[model samples]
Target: MAKLLVVGAGFAGAVHARELANAGHQVDVIDKRDHIAGNCFDYVHDCGVRIHRYGPHLFHTSNDRVVGWLSQFTGWLPYEHQVVALLDDGRKVPLPVNLDTINAVFGTRLETADDAMSYLASVALPRSPVISAEDHLYSTIGKELTDLFFRPYTKKMWQLDLSEMDAAVVRRLQIRTDRDPRYFRSDTFQALPTDGYTRAFERILDHDRISVRLTTSFSQDDMAGYDACFNSMPIDEFYEFDLGELPYRSIRFHVSHHLAATAEGLATINYTDAGPYTRETWWHALPGHRVHETSNVLRTIEEPCCYRENSLERYYPIKDRDLMYQSLYERYAARAATDDQMFFIGRCGTYQYLDMHQVINQSLVHVSKWIARS
Candidate 1:
């Protein structure tokens, strides 16, 4: 059997390690963090609530294959995530700017989906070439709602003006006329792992042919023994920034334990004001998270900053309207292609924004292709 090395121990690495091990390969998985599950890592708080260490990660995917594969490792608890934007006026409206959100903001008594669509169309200022996030938002939801809800939040989360960001960033959010409070309306399935993300990772990595090492940093020199390496380290870091740096946004999490039953009325609250904080999540609000029987709850407040500010912990890769960062990533990707024995495989490796399911799906496809060629 070939000896393979999988770096990061996140969804991408875990999936690769598991798949290769099952294919009769000896796999060794390594992660810089002490724990597995990457950003989806969660632990039971003292109060019995499961707190997501990095931030809240809601698993929602339309791919049945992904769901089926993950189901083999962990059972799921049905959870459709909901978010509300706390307006400056202390009014909480459903996010994605739905029918109720429009009525709440504009004091309109519109009943049907057509009424909401008509109202938005009347106010929307159509742009011929929508390139920037600001242009897309203005054209879809108009200036009033865009400025009220997105402008402040975007500025804080990305540390960039809406006009400077790529349209794809804002395009992820849907403007629905229906009063569907669910965050991932288009996804066919949405849920959390029955036990926890960490538990699921534990199950995934538990194999006779697989071994895992945590708190282990990866280096190019470590690639000596392994026949093949699936790397999830930042592409720029792997190349030591020979082609300059690729910008990424990271979050500073301020977690606190409160003696309350619930911190926020909803699981998550997006701050629409121009504050240092972007959003806050209450751990107890998530389904199947309240494993303990205590009145205390865990609340995590997030503040976005440059990746360098957060000890170089890269989270979201920055994308600009001019595709400047994308162009730089392409250069690094081209260089990565030169190494036949190594493959870059995760969000940082690929330099793109990917959801949990997308990361899992990517690794699945990558490993399957490699197996076929081998």
Candidate 2:
């Protein structure tokens, strides 16, 4: 059996560890944070409510294979999220800015769907060869809608002007013309682990062949003993930022509590305006088997802060020519190529945004490669 060292206990690292160990290989995993699940970590709140430590990870994917693999660890709970956007005038409307939402939001000239769609199409800027986030919205929906729905909310969310951000950042999440209120694009239905995200991770981290080192960091010397290393930590940190440390964005959550017989219809509501907060969620808002009582144990919270963090923990990659992560990546790419045995995985490892399923799929894919040699 091969010896594998996986740095970071997030989805990517955990997946790698599980895959290698399941095949009778020795796998050692470490995370400086002392947690099994990195960004998706969750715990019981003061009121005995299970809450996400790093905001919320509503697991949504169109990938069936990813869903099937995770089924081994946790049972699925069908949940399709509904997003509510707080307009500039303090009105709440459905997301994707659909025809119904458009009519409700504008509450004026855009009364009919045809009129709204036609207006949007007419105002859309001419297509551009190279598109930024600003250009994506302007080209697709028009400048007015982009300014209203995207510009201010984006400034509040990322702390940088949309004009400065990368086009890929806003290119993905789209506005569907249909009335599907479900926010996530999961294959059939969106699902969160029944017990909790943490419990599911515990199973993955507890494999007999997989040794876990929590609240600890991994180094080159630590990696030397292993036959191969799959690092899920930041790429820059792996290289000690030879070019420069890249900037990342993170949010701070302000939580509040109230004893209520019931909660609002939605599990989450988006406050796009400049209200010292970006989004709010009630733990028991989503109608299903909740981990806590609806009354006296619900958490209502606000997340704010729009700038890139100085620390190494990357929330969102600052994709711009200023940092030129691509250029720096080329340097990292060169180093990684030389190692031959070390493989970088995960958001920070590959320096790309990944959904929950994407991380798991990454590990599953790695298993195939790991098993091939045996």
Candidate 3:
């Protein structure tokens, strides 16, 4: 048995620590935050309502292995996530610009899929090389729809121009002519944890061979006794911003409670109008909660902002194809490749926009390869 160190008790760290511990290794997991589950952490308020402390995290994945592995720790509720956009005119329509959304927004009676596709083709500009997010969206859906929905919301979320962002950032946009209003329609498994994300992580870490340390920080000097170290901290930060700081966008969540039973019908609504906040989420609408008239409903407004060091939580790594950032990440990656004891994993470590399933799958794959090599 080997002693190992896992940093950052998010999905990546928890999954890796669990797998490593099960494989006859003594693992110690550390997180800078006081809680587990990282950004997916949730807590029940005094109002008898459970709200995502960071923001709404919807788990929807197509990978059977990842689902099967996580299912052992927590049961799931059959939940297909949906999103609606509050247009500039105060009209709420289904997101992903479906047939109903088009009809409602444009005041046109497009009855069939063909009608919607034809209308889009007529309005779409000439297809250009899809490089930036702006180009990809304009080529796929056209400028009018992009301007109506994505422009303002994306600008506020990323705090950058669309042209400056990588196309991979908005590659997940599901532009459909059908009537499906679900955000993740292609996913095979779509649900929230039966309990909450924090409990799920606690279950994952509940092993005799595993020890957890919260509000603790670890560095290379702490890896002397450990056989291996799986680091989930930002790669640039780990290297002390040697090449330069990689850009990341953080959020400020304004959570409030209302006596009303329902605020927004769905879980989340993106505001297309100019506002400080990008979107608002209703917490009671999530799983493991029953709506009540007297029960206070929790609403969270997500305001995206520039990331400040040691002040706020970093959520999304800025996906600008900036030459300097790319070069810096490559330099740090090369350095990690040479360090046999240190392994970088997760969104911040790799500086990629990743969903929950992707993080788990990546950790599983990486750990499997590490075990084989060891």
List the candidates ranked by lDDT, beginning with the highest. 1, 3, 2
Where does candidate 3 clash, by residue pair? none
Q: List runs of model 3 lying over 4 Å from the truth.
A: 127-132, 163-172, 290-294, 309-312
As for candidate 1, its clashing pairs are: none
Model 1, span 195-217: residue lDDT tens: 99999999999999999999999
Q: Which stretch of 10 consecutive residues in model 1 shows the poorest summed lDDT? A: 257-266
Top-lDDT candidate index: 1
Misplaced by over 4 Å in model 2 are 108-115, 122-132, 166-173, 261-263, 287-289, 298-312, 321-323
Best by TM-score: 1
Give me candidate 2's TM-score against the actual structure.
0.89
For each candidate, the alpha-carbon lDDT, in order, equals 0.91, 0.75, 0.86
Angstrom error at residue 41, model 2: 1.0
Per-residue lDDT over 280-369 for candidate 2, one digit per residue giving the tens place of the 0 to 100 score = 887766533355554654655655453343233467765664557767776787788787788888888887778888888877887678
* Clash count (model 2, backbone only): 1
lDDT of 3 by residue, 1-374 (tens): 98999999999999999999999999999999899998899887878778888889999999999999999999998998888998777888999789999888778999999999998877777556788889888887788788888888887886667778888878887778999989988998999898888999999999999999999987778888998899999998898887788887888889988865446567889888867788899888877754233457889998888888426467777655666666778889999999998999999989887999999999999998998788
